[model samples]
Each structure stands twice: as structure tokens, then as C-alpha cells.
Target: MRRDRIAAIVGIAESDIGVTPDKTVLQLQAQAAVRALTDAGLHTRDVQALFCAGAWTTWTNLMLAEYLGIQPIYTDSTNIGGSSFEAHVGHAVAGIQAGLFEVALIVYGSTQRSQRLRGKVPGEVSLTEQYEAPFGLPVPVGAYAMAAMRHMYEYGTRPEQLAEVAVAARQWAMQNPRAFARDPLSVEDVLASRMICEPLHLYDCCLVTDGGGAIVVTSERVARQCRHKPIWVLGHAETHTHHTLLSMPDVTSTGAAVTGPRAMAMAGIRHDDVDVAEIYDSFTITVIVTLEALGFCQQGEGGAFVSGGRIAPGGSFPMNTNGGGLSYCHPGMYGIFLLIEAALQLRGDAGMRQVPNAQIALVHGTGVQLSSSATVVLGRD
Candidate 1:
């Protein structure tokens, strides 16, 4: 028997994406919050809990509550990197189940691209920085490159396989008008693109664009009165094995190995039941490694799994239908966008790139240094 859903995403929306020089991060978040609330046919006054995560601004949840003119009874600003928003969905569900709150707003916004802060030096140096700064390993790309190198050595994963990920993401982007880089892309094109880190080319990396998104989670009873069909939160889980690349248990693996099975068990769904997926593509290697960890394919088989356009539009397994971070707008944290896309796909609201009969969606996020992961299983009734 299918487990009863305790909460559902009632509304979802994205702020002005790509480039928004005029809007502040808070403004972007507020825009998304209002739009999402409006989409739900609810107002700020109805929000009982607020959830947010962002390093661009301090006190994100507090600032958002004040900006939206709401005094939420509960607030969470969990900063587990890009996966924070996915974790928030689980948190919201727990709060609702505990009868602590009814309406929860989860929001995220970033101006990383506009402010040219994608790789800026942090004001404070940490333990990870102390060990990594001297080596000149570019914050995240270098870490991913190291993992790619290891995966290649152990699994004989080829560079072309990695390029296939970029190619497939671009193929989906071509179908999404909101995608940032929708131009025709090919495997050859990805291989020929400028190299950012070893093995990972420019095309293999996710776009650094300004974007923001929000989602409203509420009890099933409250969701029934919303503007759209409630996309039920079937299951969710998150975990992190390390805070730095140096501390990672294994470069070829991610936290998804632990979270995937747990979340799936909670949702009571098998891998074949997922109609669509929105896995974070911070880098091409990120997707390959994550898919392996998520058990979509056996370890080291991610290369073969993603090749032959298997994950592209009209393929055996449709994924990242919104173009993903590789082609879509990837602000500092891409987790919130993952949830937003999953909710849209589950709602059957995606227009040109909508996956047919997308009843169950698997949304996964990889955080900084591939150290953290969060997975959520969503379904339509």
C-alpha cells in the first residue's frame, strides 16, 4: 500500500533568471515568495513557517520573513550547501507532521553571476582552506576534477562519456525557452570547449547565472484548497560525509549512496517508478557520480548509463527537463531549483519539455565539494 503523504508542495515559482542586475538577493527571494504564494492562492499572512538557505546574505530566513511581511512561528536557515533547500522540504514535512506549523515557505536567491562572486575569496579562512589554499586547487572545479580523474582510473570512464552529460543537458535546454544556453550542442562540441579543470571542460561545468526560486509546503488538507494540484512530498533524505575534498571517504562516491535507498524506502517506490528526474549538474562528473550513488546504475557504470542519449529528451530515462544547472540558470545553490523543477514536472505544468505522464519525480542535489547530498521523491495523486 502507498504510504499517506503528510505534506505537499502547493505552489512553486522562479524569480527573474539569467541576469538581474537591478534586483538584490533579498528582492529576488521576495519576488519568488510572493509569486509562489500567489500561485498557491495564499498570502504572507498564511505562512506559519519559513525556511531558507544562502551564504550570500546573513540571517536569510529572518530577512525573508521581514521582507515578505510575515512573522512565521518557526524558521530554518540550514546551510548544507546547495542541498539545503531539498533538506528543507523534509524539515517542513516533519514540522507539519508534528503539528508545529501548517504553511511553510522555502526560498533561495543568488546574484553570484551578476556580482562576479562565483570564485571570490572568502573573508575568513577555514580548516579546509588552510589545507587547500596553498595547492591552488580552484575552490570546487579542482575537487571535481580530482574525483573525475579517480573515476577514470578505476572505472575506465572516458572523457567522451563526461561530454555526453553536457551534450544531453544542452539537448534538453534546446527544448526549454527559459534555459540559459539553449544553442545546439554536441559531444564533439563539449570535448572541444575550453578546459576549466583537467578532464572537465567549460561546457561540462554548470552556468553561473543569477536566479531564485521558492516553494510552499503545507498539509494535505490545506493543499487541497490551493491554486494547483498538490505535488505530494512522498519522501526525502539528506547526508554529508565530509566538509572538504581532503576528507571525502571516496572521490568516486557521494552521500547519495546512503540517502537514495533511505528516501526511496520511505516513499515506497522502486527505481522504475520514477517518471522523471531533476538531478543537480554542478558539473558533468557530478551527475555521473551522483547517478552511480543513487543506484540508477551500478558503481562506475554511470558513464555507460548516460551515453547514447539515454538521459536526454525522448530518451529511455528523461532527466533535468528544465535544462539543469549545466544549461539552466545555476545560482550559487542549485538545490532549490531542483525542487522547483521536480514540482513543476510532477504537476504536469512543464510546457514544451514536459515529460509525458511524469507522475513520480526523483530530485537530487549535490552540495559543495560533492560532500553533501539530498534526495526527495515527489509524486502526483
Candidate 2:
């Protein structure tokens, strides 16, 4: 009934995530795509499908397919804010199951920090303008700031609780050489940092970075011959609770509340089976809210769940081992990084950051003030 699904993530690659002043967006995408193809031990001619996403750049599937010198039997250019990459994975899976393509490549690149590309203005009233942009909120930090303030008022979530997320992420980053923010931080450090919005300090937010990442997916039969073991996509789902933070019924919970169970059920996995988690951390509050919605803890226990050394390196749950968006490079949309980290861990390629016997992983992406949500269950075959 599930269409006898067979997909394998054979390759993963990324450029330096923090500051890439030397390369164009296309160059970055090409580099990651090439690296992924090499990792899979496949040539460019083997690809039959292509998918891409971005805001300021014209990321066309055809252009990439042509650049890579492959004739795609199918192509997708779905762009849904920050959740685009995660959504792309679902679309690729559906396309593969429908017999539309045998192999598909998903790629994303951004130059926001280096190129200084200002995304579509929040207030610009075009058909493409986001509804929330009409209000004074333009950037993601402002929208998330509103939610953080509400959590503080309603659940008595403290600044230290928020700071704890940053602190834990930084500690993990120190162990990851590719992580951009390896510096140690404290609650006092976060509190003393510059204020982007009330109750949301600079350290509470993610970094604006320039980078790219890509992954290759193919039928399970073809994956057996690849260079590495396939990280199977056991289950995946995407949902939207609200298009804007203002319309959210409750900012405390996320669309993950709806999507998480569906994905896990599809995979026939329980919460206890997940050995690693790569939850997106666009803002400190984002991770806290997702933890609760994903059933890591009770509705309002996110503060206490992360209070002790639980999410740290040697804690009960080792999260964001490559550092999350909180400590890793956030090149505009950071969802792709989560997928890369999850796949690497399942493949046991995470080196010193590797969790012991990581057999299953849960990777989540939060896009546009928790407007769009995606969840994926990955397991080792």
C-alpha cells in the first residue's frame, strides 16, 4: 500500500558555510553537486532528475541539469521559503515512487551575507508578497521575537532557558571543525549581547551566511552499487499551521505537532528509537518549541528539558552534533544542513561528533517563523 518505497541518499556535500566571498551562487551549487555525485561514485550522466531552491537567484532545474550535462526526465523548482529543501525531499520521494524518475538530485545555494542580497521586502505588496510582510515584520528574527516574548509571558520561560540552547549548541560546535560558531557562550554572554529585539539578543539568533549543500537520491536497487551504504528515507511529511506568525493559533506549538506523528507512523518508528536528532535552530525559541511539539518533552517542559546537560555533548540526547543553525552556518534557509548532518551520522561518517550506534535519526526544519514545518525519519539499512 505504501508503493513499496525504495530510495537511498547516496551522496552529500557542502561548501564552506560561513563566508564565501570568492564564489558565485552557481559556483557553490555546482561544487556541492559535483561533490555529492563523487560521493555516490556516480557520474553526472547518471542523474535523471534535478531540483533546486532559492530566493534572490534564479535556481532553475533545467539550467542545473544542462550545466551538469544531463537530460532530466523530471524536474522540480518548488520554493517555499526556508522549508524549500525539506519540501523538496518529499517531492522527490513522490516522484520516484510514481515511476517518473529513477534518480533525483536536490540542491540549494544562497549568498545573502557575502553578496548582500536583500530578499524581497516584507512590505512590498506584490502577488508574491507574504501576508505577514504587510505588517512591520520583515525579517525572521522579528517574527520569532514575538513568539519568544509570548512564551516568556505565558510559560515563564526565562532568558537563561533561551541562552541554554545557544550555550549547548556552541559547546557542540567546538567539537565540529566545520561549525562556524565554535566560541563558548554563557547566559550572561547572551544577555549582554546586542539586542535585535526585546528579549531576543543577537546570540539568540542565527548567523547570516553564504553557502550551499546538495544530496543525491536514487532507487534502492541502484544504491546497492554505490560507494557508501544508503541512508533510507523511512518516512517524511510536511505541514503548514499558519502562513504567518500573527495568524498562528498558539505560537508555543508548531506544525510539527501535526506532521511529526504522521511521519513516524509511516516509518513504523517510536520516539524512543531515534538515536540522534537534527532539529533546526533558526532562533533559540524555535528549537524549544519543536522539542515540545516533537514529543521530546511535555508542552511547557522545554525549559527544564534543556536546563541540565541533557542536550549537551554527553547528555541523554545529543542534538545538533554538527552544531545547529544556532552554531552552524545559516545560509539563509538552513534546513539542508540538518539533512546533511543526519545522513552523515546515520552513515557513521561524523567522526568525533558521532553518536554511539546511531541507527535512526529525526531531522526537522522550521521555516518562516514556524510557518512551514517538515519532518524526516532516516534509518540505516
Candidate 3:
């Protein structure tokens, strides 16, 4: 396969980003799809492929394509939780490379927080749930909390170090109008926030909002005529270590360790070559472990890598510049938001959260219990 045919992202947008109760799931997806099409100055007829991770409905890819009145030549519905969108990007690139599709639309939407907002978990019938749910694994928060505890125990990481991540996210959120939690935060403030689970404060967790996002991908031949400057899909990879927390190889490590190197190698770049990063932050622990797993630092050094505001604004490297799922909107699966933020940075349209002259971006997504992972390297060069 030729690498030069990797798809380019020409259009991206998030519709009804926060607290959208009145909108239906399809409405949210359609609004975002239309906006992204408008952003690229293209029409639905131009979309040769469609992909979606619709958590709310079945046949989501077909449904969205029908709603948009687009008869796609190809489609994908690879539901790998939050990393689905990143995986869709990888599939679209491959499809484009193989001449299977000329243009593709990847979209996501969720009403998990608005209409059905309650203590609803992933139900009691998944393959992994069969094994873990019997023991009441607390689904997600408790699982992540355990990871935090282990990380702290193994690396001597302090709660203050984790607090810094929330504090820095807020600092970035203050500049993003679409962020769900923009109030200024401090390490002490995070420390003082009500504890959701041991070692993981409420501030350390992501927001529960109703929102949706969409991205339009196209081949190099077609992207040249698009409206925005093309953001190249340089390289990408995805993997998952386990289906349940108990099955996870190690709480301190994730699939990013493998996918990161694979992606960078395909992109022909090193860690230092990345100008910005948009990593999943379902919880502060996710960021810490993922950073270490992705080779940003040695294992267990993630606590110190983010210490003293290295990931905050005006720091050596800006992370989750969209306020992340921590301060920004986390409407169930948050992988799509990571891609949108990276595209914004590469396009020099990030406004106050922009990293100056950001040429390359590393976007990584993690799913439930860190069971699913995906990494993508995007560049303007």
C-alpha cells in the first residue's frame, strides 16, 4: 500500500457541543454533518463514504447517510467505544488509498447525559460484563480509580500531581467558549473538590454533557479543491489490551505504548517532532498512564512529565487544548473531539487555545477501562 494516498481532513465541526437537551441524536449528528460539509464547501453528493459510531441507535452509519440523503459507496461502523472515530479515520485513509472511496464522512453523537441522564452503565450483557459485572466492578470510575491508586503506589505520585491536570485543563477551557466547565481551577481547588472515587476527585473526571461532532475526510486528489487547508492524515494505529479492567495486563500501561511507536514510525517522525497533542482524559489517570504508554516519558514518570504545568498553556507542549473531556464536553465517547481539536490547531484556528505554529499533532483516544486505544498523527506539512 502506498502511504502518499493517506486521506486529508478538510472539514470538521462540533454541533451543539454542550447541554443540548432539545436536540435528538440524529438532529445533533445532522447539524454537525451539515456544518462540516459547509466548512469544506462541499455537498452531500460529494461524500462517497459514511462512517459513524452511533451509541444511541443501530445501523447508525446507514441512518445518518439516509438523513443526509447521501448514498455512500462505502460505510463503516467500527464501534470501539471512544476510539471509534480515530479508527474511522484510519479506515477512511485506507479506503482512500485503495481507491474504494473518494470522500468520507465520520460522525458521532450521544444523548447519554441529557434525556437519559442518570446512573446508567453499559448494561449487564456485554461479553466482558459477563465476567466483571457479577462482581460489581463499579463500571468505570472505580476501575480508573484503581489505576490511579496503583500508579501512585508504584511511582510515589501524589494527588497534587493529578490535581495539576484538572487545573491546567480549566486554564485552557477559560479560552474555549464551547467548554462545559470553564471556571478557573487550581491544584488546591481540585484537591478540595468532592471525591467521586478514591484518588479521583470530581474535577479529575470528565463532564457529562449532551453533544456531537463530525469530520469530513477526503483523498489527496479531492482535498486539493476543498475550502480549508488540508490536514494530512500522516499515520495512525489502534489496539486494545483487554475487555475488562481485571483482564488488563497492567494498570500503569496501555496500548498507546505499542500504537504510538507504530504510528510515529509510519509518519516518519519522532516524539520531539510533535507540536501538540489531544489525548483522551476520561480521568486524570488516563492522561498520566497514556502519556507514559505513548513514550512521552518513561513508565511511572507521567506524574512528573505533567508536573509544574508542562501541558498547560504557554508550556513546552500543549495538551487537550480544547479543555479536554475534563473541562470540555464529554458526551459519552470523546474520541471525535480529539480529532476536531487537532484539526483546529493544525489549521491555526484554535483561537485563544491555539499553540503557535503547530505543524504536527498527536491525537490518542482511550475507551472503557482503557480497553480500546487509537492513535493518529496529523500534520500540515
Candidate 4:
């Protein structure tokens, strides 16, 4: 049986993404949800489903539904690291198609920057943590650093090549008034920045910020009456490569190797047909690996592919138009923000950072050192 062709994104909203110290995670989630509902010209009463995900926050779907004065028929609190938000879109689409519910609200919020604490271990420790954390592989930077070093050794990748990603993201951030990393950086700047890990410098990492983002999905019939033009979900696919760094087959690739072709085939589009892309950038290496996995370049050519101003603002493929997690705000898991930015660009709502005549967009999300991957193809309808 063919899956139901249901669910179109009708509205998207995000709070001021940088250093929002005053708001709690719940408040940020509520504000973003209300804004999205308002943008869709719908009342709180119209919402019938809610999906939320994050770490270090409340699992308050019912509480939020009560706060918004709506009674949701269905609720989800799935947490799959950063890719949770994007995964929710796929789940919501399936739910709607299965006649479980309609008008689902997927939201994410975090206050990582304002909260300070002594270096403490995360609440839940996986088996991988039991094995690796004992050996000083505690944080994400360290895990990705090993991957970067391997790529450099095998592919002759240069530090300058990784710096190019950060530089291009900052250039786009300069154009985005709401972007967090407004200050631009050069290759020299990146190389000179303080080292967090041996291969990954301070500039090569994503920022910690306080922010929230939300998206409203509804059946196509309802989207026709919403405030903004609907950005149809042409196709979407997801894959889990591994749960831990040690279990991965190769550090230099991602589950995108599987997800990219599956999603493109579902959308009936090719790489050349994609007009814009918003690949998640939790680390510079994430982008490089994804670029190669998604057919932007050959397996070991990501470094050369990103060189010479290819991903800059006015280049052939303008990536991370809202500055990405690199130059934009990476409030913990930043995959949701990617979907928000991509939807806005497809709707033609991005003022200055908008890509001209953009009709097709490819948005990708990565979680936990390439553990989980999701790709969505969006089209203007």
C-alpha cells in the first residue's frame, strides 16, 4: 500500500537565538509554539498534537498543551540526540498518514549558555560511555577530534580546508541580523584560535547558546488555508549508523551515505535539481563528511570541494544561509534550527539572506557524532 501523502509544513518560528538568559526552556518552547501558530493564522485551539525533544529539559508536552489552552490528542517526547527534531517530522508525517492525528507541532528549546556548572557527567551513561569516558573521551569535541585527525591523515585534508567552512559560515552570519557569530574569521583566524582538542580548534566548533525553534505541520487540505505558503514535504529518510564512536565502521563518513539517495529517490529529484542546502554543522568535520556522503563530492574530496569560496554567500551552493550552527546559535542540538531556516527560505520569508528563485531545498540533520541521520527534501507548493 502507498503511504498517505499527508502533512505539509505551514508555519515556522524561532525566538531571538543568542544569549537569552531570562527565559527558561519551557518558556522558550511556549513562545516559539505560539509564534508558529500565529504565523499560520491558527489559534491554540487548532493544535491537536505535540512533539518535543531535547536534553537537560522538561518532558512537558501535556503541560505545554495545557499552557497553550489546547488538548492534544497525541503527544511525543522522543529524544534521539540532536536529530530528534528532524526525526519528529518524519514521525508526525507517518502519524498523520495513519490517521492518528493532524496538526502536529514539533518544538525544541534549550538554555545551555546561561547555565554554568562544574564539569559533571551526563545523567545517563551508555555502555559506550562506560568504555570510552574512562579513557578521556568524555565530550563531543574529543570524539570528533579523533575523526578529524583520521581524515587529515588519510585524505591529506588541511586545517585551512576546515577553516574554510567556519569562514564561509561567518560571512553568511554577517548578513543575518539575528545570527550569533557576527564576527567573521579568516583561515589564519581559525588556525590561530585556541585549541580545544589537538585537531579541532575553538573556531572549528559550534557555539553554545540559549534558543528555541518550532514548526507546525498539518494535512495538505488544512495547509491551503494557513497564513504562509505551504512547503511540501517532498520526501524524507532516516538512518542510524551506530550508537557510539567505537561502533562506527568509518569515522570519515555518516549515515548520510544511505539516507541521501533514499530521500532523493523519494522526492524524485537529483543532486543537481536541489537549489539550496542546509546541512547540520555541529562541527566543521560534520559538514565535510556530509558533503562527501551526499554526493556533493567524491569520498575524500570534501576538503577540495569546499575550497575557493564554493559555500560562501554568493557561491554556487549557498549552505547554511542562517549561518548554521557554526556561525549561528547552536543551542545544544541544532538540527531543528536547520529545518526552520530551510522552511523560511523556501517560503521566501528570509529578508536579505534569501536565495533567489529557490524552489527546492535539502535539509539534513546529524546526531551524536554521526550516530543518527535524517534528510528532508522540501519544495515550494
Which predicted model would earn the best lDDT? Answer: 1
lDDT of 2 by residue, 1-381 (tens): 132447878899896678999987778888899998899988788888888877754747767667778788888887766767777787888887887887788888888898886445643566434555666664778888888888888888998999899988988899899988888888899999999887889999988889999998888877888999998888888988776566789988998887788888888888888899999899999989999998989988888788787888998898988988888888988888898999999999998889999988998888876888999888887
| Regions of candidate 1 where Cα sits further than 4 Å from its true position | none
What TM-score against the true fold does each predicted structure earn? 0.98, 0.95, 0.97, 0.95
List residue ranges in candidate 4 displaced over 4 A: 1-5, 58-60, 117-119, 122-126
Local accuracy of candidate 1 as per-residue lDDT tens digits, 183-286: 99998998899999898999989999998999999999999999899999999999989986889989999999998998899999999999999998999999
Query: How far in Å is the alpha carbon of 343 misplaced in model 1?
Result: 1.2
Per-residue error (Å), model 4, residue 119: 5.5
Ten residues in a row with the worst lDDT in model 3? 117-126
What TM-score would candidate 4 get against the native?
0.95
Better of 2 and 4 by lDDT: 4
Give per-residue CA lDDT, model 4, range 163-262, as digits (tens): 9999999998998999998986899999999998879999999988889999999888788899888888877888898877899899999989888888
For model 2, the stretches where C-alpha displacement exceeds 4 angstroms are 1-5, 118-123, 127-135
* Candidate models: Cα lDDT each: 0.91, 0.84, 0.89, 0.85
Per-residue lDDT of model 3, residues 1-381, tens digit only? 214646799999998978877898999999999999889989888888999996677788778888989898998999988888988898999898888988899899887787875356554566646876766656588899999999999999999989888888888899899899988898988899898889999888988888899999998988899999999999999998887787888998999998899888888888899999999999999999999999999999999999898999988979999999999999989999999999999999999888999998999999988888999999995
Native-to-model Cα distance after best TM-score fit, residue 102 in candidate 4, in Å: 2.0
| lDDT for predicted candidate 2 compared with the true structure | 0.84
